[model samples]
Target: MTAETHAVRRGSARSHTVPTATGGGKRRDIQGLRALAVGLVVVFHLLPSLVPGGYIGVDVFFVISGFLITAHLVRELESTGRVRITEFWARRVRRLLPASLLVLAVCVVLTFTVMPAITRPQNFTEIAFASGYVLNWNLAASAVDYLNATNPESLVQHYWSLSVEEQFYLVWPILLTVAVFIAARSRMRAPSTRPLSASVTTRRGVLAALLLVFILSLAFSIYETARSQPSAYFITTTRAWEFALGGLVALVPGLRLSEALRAALSWIALGAIVACAFLFGPGTAFPGSIALIPVIATAILILVGDSRAAFSPQRLAHVAPVQSVGDLSYSIYLWHWPLIVVVAANVSAWPSWVRIPLILVVTYVLAVVTERFVERPFRKPRGAFRRRSVTFGTMAASIGVIVTVTVLATVGIQNAVDQRQDDLQEQLSGGGSSSSECIGAQAVYNDCADPFAYTDLVDPAFAQEDGPWAWFDSELAATACSSATVGSWVERSCAFDGASDDDPQVLLIGDSHADHIASPLQRIAEDRGWALRVETRQACNPFRVAAESDDENAARCASWGADVIAQTVADPDIDVVIVSTRGDSGVWEANAATAFRDLEAAGKSVVVVSDTPNVDGRQVSNGDLITGPACVLAAGSVDDACSWDDERRDTWVEDTAAAEGVPVLDLRSLVCPDGVCHAIVGGLIAFSDENHLSGSYALSLAGWFDRELTPIIDGASARG
Candidate 1:
């Protein structure tokens, strides 16, 4: 949402003064710009393909915020000789917090009633972060976390941009005050016969400081985006440059052009913005050099005077429809995302044609109501909220209530989860129970015996505990040995050292799919007295191929795979190599075959593990990845909602294994049986998310895995 500012009336003549913090008429053109920016963001979220680069709307808002806020700060300093920090902050609180808090409260209520129980804790935590104005950092952390990386879009994910703006609001005023102070001190130190204009000197000082910050921050943004793209996208350090650019524009003295020239530049700048939105997509490395396109365009649009020339961009921007959207931009931004998420999660069966318009219309109506009732009321003068103490107190109370409720709800959910886990453990401990027959593949497509005859298809006690999500706490995730992204490779070697150093050295390599099997492999290595080394990356395969659309990640994956191959071939101690990956992509076959050939040529035996069954029909509701177990827990006997066709298992991996004369260890029976895959087998949750096997389930396969794997390794070693 654009920062709240008083609307400026359109200039009637060319000589009219531009809008400023101290004294100037409103600029309807800027409001139209706000409308345009929010429109892009809304459309992008609704139909991403239609406006691929619509996310740049956030950059537009950032620039607008920087310009307007900086102008106000400079004007206050010029008019009053000192900045009122408390008053400045109070004004910001009054303008932004009421609607934000109202929306947050509504989202929290929905989280309890409509959101999946599996994601309530995370949603609550995000709510707390959003309320505290630190959602950006929270999101930045999640961006780098492998487990959280693919999390469904959060209702409050959009709050990250608001967090960034709020942070800017907090710090920018303080920085300006410091600059003004420094300028005053420098003027006092100078022995001058003639007095200098303090306002001009202060403005110059602030501008110079802002320019330096802009350059440094922009450089950092570029460097960070290259080094860590995910982190760069959300962190404040990488985004400060956008705001600094706006501040620079605000600080410029008497920036004016002829009406014709201004109109021409505005149109070109607007076109550049629309072009960036259409051309860019998720693959684009953002807020780096590429981000310069939109940032610069937004700045130019703001810089061009609001001239009402015929066919002028300003005149078009000032249209009533556009202005209305702009007027409600803040509330629209706050309301739209959560509504989109909620609707998508709950009403996904509704066609996109039906869903998109409904989402927009509902969002607009809510925005109007919130803008009128919530935002405007708090901001009005001579109201109860006008008093700084009342405003601050109300804000504090609102935040306190949100945090308190979130914490209580999280605790209650955790308790329920704990109790459910205890029940599962009890069931497992009771060895010869009737439930054992229905465990694993036997339970699939078997109406002969009821697995939950004694209990429930999904246990009633643990049904609301988010059983599938609880599986994330498994050993594999806790260790974090696998690569999170393309370039993040960490070598993890587990050597039993039970006998001599000459013990059979085994190497496990692949993507996160390989990492999921690491716990069981490590257990086997310790028990069997073997040296096991794991080298895996998220989404990376051991074979050299373009597995991902991101060129950098694909190249890195290829390079990493090549290095692993070279090392495996060179080491005489390496007796066996095991390759595992999510075989969802057929492109992986060629690479797997190549790795197999090279390893066999070096006299090292190879075994390829079959890819596991993903929860085929699962839906990611409201940013939470709903798994089979989660679905079953939510609605008992979901009629194969969580199962997939076992026949569709990745054939390329199997084919490569067959061609290379290596044993292909098909774990399909363990995960999916009788042509159907189930979400929960026995009492254990199967998959963590959609594809990756839960650590608990994988570890539970230790017995079956060991029994099946020993003979193959033994035969291979005897031949060697």
Candidate 2:
């Protein structure tokens, strides 16, 4: 999911209830919770291996936000008989936007100056989305996208939680308003003799609505997490339950316990929160059942009421240091992530002990400065900044400026990318004059005609200017010809290689790896007058024993694979079944062997393509995952600087093909020459990310592909 940067509630009084401009007191215990939540997140970011579940801190913030915001709204409704939506929104703007926009502006400047050109476009887009409080939807879409899923995290990735909170702020007041109206109408319709007042009726109605929302959202969260974990994590609907749980605590009455009982519950809640932060991890199916640990714990702590007992957890929370950190929590959350990302990007190997302290000191300094100069000034009611219109106008202008600058920067970067693509294309076309002599399996590995070569430059451009790497999606991904989401299967077929109703049918099957090669294969199919049907899924291997976890995806992939095999066997016109995947290890080889054997028994010829070498050197910088090629390019180093020298001896495909007596195609020689896998080969960026091939690189292999495939297809046709 996403991280949220929550502002500390500003007030002078000391009480458990949320503070309002009118009168409610401060909750030092709540501030301590804020300190604890941010502390977990900061530590998690600094040393994730040490605190694997620190991400749960974000959920804690969500619960705190829901409880506090709901309490404030309910208080307003009780006092005024109606919620002031605009005034509430104005206060939120004053409290949150100034600090948030400052961070965005600084991040944008850093993106253009220090971040890689290839990553700027995406970051800029995210900046725009974050500014508009819709980053969650953008992240949700990217999360489910098979190609985008592998992308390194964004600098603004943490903004999704803030976006979620803002969305709640926008809608919750409107819902309360409606509830108030219903309550008022009900009270009016009741006899004048009725005992219940309008406020009581309204409160009951609001409580009922909140309860319904909490139930529905919690159920959706459970279902969606099981079905599509990635989407579930970022989507507002799945996360609304956590917020609603907090709201229920605020709206529901008679929840306060005796001081002794409260203290006990408080300690239990604190233990639960701490235990979750230590125990939960990435592999944990989050915000589902596991998320209840942190969410419920946070809710319980809020409901227990802050106690002054010597042994009370609230007393510990009320300590000066914790309250101080809580005071700086918002600005610290805003500053820390980008700083970490920038530092990591530049010096990824920095030890955590050193990095953590450095990040903390710098983030604290910046946060203190921002909070004093930016946050407090606008928030105080003693100056010109106190004007509601001034605060609202300033917030609006700051957002507009961020959007404008991000757009201009993105457009400029895209233009540069387009120009570089054109130049690369020209060089590639001219270099291909010797294609006849150099375009084959043997010539591909040596100093043959390098279409992507740049003679004048000292280093190859590691980042693909225009290819799969440039945009994570390839031709197949763009066309939606394969399954890109989890637990969902959509069999998409398209005619390729000028194949018509009478042409021989060729079926391509497997996962995303199969889809990556579809471009070159499409050209081959068109040249040979064959119809190519591509059947693939995000992580589905199409193996007899599915390699994926035994979840919904595994079941769907198993069923999908069986249906595809049956159709291939049943269709007499289907001449060959081509299988390829990213790797050959695990259960894939076994599954591939079974599929090949089944096709052979059905009198269908099978072609098994060996998996490509995966170069693993990408590092997380400033939140984004910078690829080896991009890193090398940014450093102005030769391709060897990022090249992988070790041999990938996984010949599972060849071994399985031998066992099954099927034809095999190995593209290793073409992609990795002289037993070395380079991030950039010839003049083109070799890989889309670490594992998948760039569309341009894959397309460049068309000549060699046709050379090897023609014999297999011809022999199959001859046999037929």
Candidate 3:
């Protein structure tokens, strides 16, 4: 989960540097800054312990890009009083699209060939987003979605930073053009003898506008960072302030500073940035008010002006190795991530010492070759290629090719998935389900000749994607009510109709863990002549365990829990209540015990279901951190593929239920047979991803649910 948010583009070698207020050739210090930022990001991804806050390197890149691009655009705006949006876009396309599109194309090929098949659908989906320069928004949405909880980072996830860069390339130029328009109007209205010339008016207007963007975006960044850090981290709105700060530096007039002072300030700012890299970590809430520390320091470093004083930061930046790395930072960033991910997947046993240097060497070589062949040729191309229409056309075609490649690859993968579904279905019809000797729990629990005999199910490539889906609605989920309707009691609550008023009224309530059981419970209701209503919320236990946190989400969950508890108790038609949750803390257990007592006092029958076999979260006896989903994906249902959880889950369930003298529906035998659990049970992918019970596997256990729940339903019917 390292966020390796690499910055995308760099100028070609002929004139790769930006000028200060005082015009100059390539700035070795700026190049050094690129080296520092990329080095931090690369090291963070490779050696996170050494540089946890290295992710802030992306913010540094953001500022560098904003400053460089805004400087280039404003020079034109001040000279001409108008900005050419298409011409600006065409230049960006030439500098970036060739290298980026080539990498994306290569990624498409690797996803089809080298990457794990289970990851292709997601990988290709993100590739499409990256192709459109919208991967940041896609990532922001995914970060907040509970359904995507186990969706691992894709090969091109690092493109999110580049996506933000592309969006800025589009918007910033337009904003500058508008600033020029405002300046032109003001100039026309000014007196003929006015001292403020056209260039001064335009610069003043742009400075004012950029300053507004800085303030508004920084305030929004702070506000949103506190509200939703995950989403805040990737969105353009929250990050625009970083770029605005850089733009302000680009436009602001420079000071006449002594060499010693410039060197002192540059080195200090540079050290502060590197120090912040060490200070931050995965747990840190990013790019909020805290981000201002590094962002402001970067602007100050730029503001002080570039210098090559022997002890200054620029001297270190200009060193042969640093300058070389900075020259290829964009290409290195692109190639290194996919290579590292692929190597880790294929050779996980290799230690970091071996993997890190090997990846960096290979990455540097690739970067050198890509910059030489792909990047240089396309940038500032000759006659026909330099035409704005041709550059635009080439960009469109490159995007089309990537989209086409991804679509074709995805279709082929889907076809294989479809064939897998057919094969599993054929097995089921050929007595996989009827005998109860294979598929799901029976294969393990029953006295079958070979417990793993049937082994008939969709391939892990397809099955790992399975998840609880009862929250979706055609009708009974209520109008405009679905998984998105969480945060309140009145929404996302579904009611399955009963045949008659006298039918036993049952309510299944809790969080996502409760949702996994919906498949079988609905079958139980239909078969046993009972009415069922499934009321589940994301991460919100029926007991409101989040009451301790002051977060808005926690408050919403707390309010929802209180509302459901009272409403379920007040509704006389409700006869039985079933509760299950992941039970994040001991507070949930105490609250569950209290809730059980309340239900019993209301004359309602209650059943407590134990949490699932949790090898995914629990520590192993040998202290190995192997995950069940990962084991299943690699080893299938083979011997020793089965693993044991810490064995505390069953005890917790019993202790919570025993407090109120309620019956605990202990289904450990079905999930973890005799203290051993298989990644795939009864030939079905037992978990959606490591933990959540897959809907398909849950449905396969319908027979067991019927046998066990019949008594509870009969008693509830008698009570009703």
Candidate 4:
């Protein structure tokens, strides 16, 4: 649906100087570069797990943007003898803002229509922050989060990069202006007959300085990419170098290289980019050595492709489809992501087959409308109003929308679907709490007033400041804080006393989630009268162990998990090795299978506990049911909300345990009943927030483990 809006006036005077497109190439080369970068990003986003290296497309875009923007700025400075900052910004606003604001507006509307009231408030706040151009900061504060789920305002997470570039333009122009002022002043004061080479030398010097900064920043970015991929991926500081590198490339006056070198370089650059694309899928090292390929490839196209080149890529880039995409690239980039995210969030299912075409069609339509209407009018010659006032009015309109959205989000948050929490007041008011009597009672301790039995269930407080069951245990709040504070570790202070040299053995090793399970392990060890030995770290899943990023802590955790397993197996005195940890690539699951194999070969009894369910790693309990009536309405169904899915139960938890040749305990079924999962079982809350079981609930589950583990222990001796 396309809407036509009226013209608005700019603040004051508008710079009338129009930009002169420089450096003739068959427009194809530029278009091809744009196509390649955009296609890579789209594919990567559709299936990041499949294309780990595809994210390099953003870097590619940065380089292209840097080159184009710098080239334009340099040309203007040289021709006009002055760069008009206002006009530059006006052009930027016309080109970028209209489409962006439209996307934000759509996201806000979709969020209201589709997202659950419980989560909608947070999403709205995120969207407002994103609109205000502080999304990077907002996301950085959250850190390492992949905003792919049903977030209220997450439709536009990808816009953070655009925000970074916008921010760059905001500051870069002033710096360029300073450089221009200096150069012009120097030229005027110097002898008029000075050789033209002097101008070339001055440009070269400035370009050289920019190049040094770019190189140095790139080095830092590479280091950080390995150390903290998430930070390196998102933060602007680490990324500025790519843009600067492109700007540096633009500064070179004459690229008169031999055709052989050009072709060789082009082929090499193309090979680098293609290689990175195929081999460097998602989760691969990035902004590191891997990034150089695409960045350099983009540079090759800009530098080597010219009118004389026999097989210039410019023709390819300039094709109708490519140019169309390139023309609306800004708008396509802005609108496509949010549309895809919102559709995914609302639909609750995503597959490449469906999503790929959907994103393309939606992006094309949005981009075309935004370009034809919102953008062209403000920039083109118009008699109704001055461009500067229109720009000002647009800015004011955006801020006004921002204010309105912010207020609505606040009100929505304040009035987030309220439940009859009074029922909760009565349950806690009574003696202790009622035991959960649901069908899955064995798997769920909530039937026995076990607070942690439903740790995976959503709670009411989720919509409130404190969340559901805030009264049951303040530790729910404390635990989250504690989890964050533990930091990433190579080793941790044991939660329980260590087993003596002569005592029957207890082996503990796993990831951060496993560490969280330490509370339960300590109780089990005490009840069984065994020494507890634990080896675990934050984010170090024992299943797939690999040292990928530059985070020192991840490295330490990887080494520790392997060493701990080897040492436990070597000890003949150790009777039982309990290898429990969160599984999967996220927590270094690569090493888990080997760790289990070694234990089995050593003839040590290994018990691998399955991982609990979590949303974005945050523990969610059924407590969300208390504040809203959605669960109440869907109370009788065997659908997802009422029943645990196979992914959480069989795949992540059960599959890992079974693969390692250990007894797999499916706890989810025990916690949910009648196809309904409740965060609070019986009258007691199960999970503190999402996954971590409350201390009391964990203690209560000890007997269930005793029933299961006792049989395993009894059978081990007889079999041996």
- lDDT at residue 474 of model 3 (Cα atoms): 40
> Where does candidate 2 have its weakest 10-residue lDDT segment?
1-10
Off by over 4 Å in 4: 1-26, 47-52, 80-82, 116-122, 145-153, 179-205, 257-264, 306-310, 346-355, 381-390, 414-426, 432-551, 555-720
**Candidate 3 segments exceeding 4 Å error:** 1-22, 187-195, 415-437, 445-447, 452-458, 470-481, 485-491, 545-549, 616-627, 640-642, 649-654
lDDT of 3 by residue, 1-720 (tens): 011111212333222232354353566667777888899999998888999999999999899888888887788887777888899898788888888888888888888889877788889999999999999999988887766745766889999999999999999999988877887787788787757877788888888889889899999998888787888999999999899889888877645556666667777888889889999887887878899889988988777655544556666775799988888989988998888888866776677789888999999999999999988887758989989998888789889989888888778877876666555445533554455446666565555545543254535676656656632334644542344543222235667777788888989887778888886787667777788888888767667656455576677777788789888888888998888766653366676677788888897998878778665523321233434455565554464454554365435545778777998887666777666665667666677666677756676666677777788878877766
Give one digit per residue, the lDDT tens place, for model 2 in 450-548. 533432322223343334423322574456343334354334444453356666667888776777787778767777887777877656666646445
Q: Please give the clash total of every predicted structure, in order.
A: 5, 6, 2, 67
Worst 10 residues of 4 by lDDT: 1-10
**Which pairs clash in model 1?**
8-26, 8-27, 9-26, 53-277, 152-623
TM-score winner between candidates 3 and 4: 3
For each candidate, what is the lDDT?
Answer: 0.74, 0.71, 0.75, 0.58
Per-residue lDDT of 157 in model 1: 87
Candidate that would win on TM-score: 3
Better of 2 and 4 by TM-score: 2
| Cα RMSD to the true fold for all candidates | 4.7, 4.9, 5.0, 10.2
Clashing pairs for predicted structure model 3, backbone only: 439-682, 440-682
- Write candidate 1's Cα lDDT for 1-720 as tens digits: 334343444554553344333446566777888999999999999989999999999999998888888888887888888888988889899889989999999999989889766667778889989998999999988887655665667679899999999999899989989988888888889989987898887887788778877999999999888877888899998999899998888876554455666677778998999999999999898989999989999888777646566767778776789889989999999999999988876787687899989999999999999988878776765667678888889889999999999989878877867775666445433455555434433343232253222234344224333322244335644553333334433333333342467667788888778877876677677778777777777666667665455456667877877888898899888888888877664466776777788899998989888888666544423334465445555444443334546666456777878987988887776666667666666544566566777645565555566877788767766776
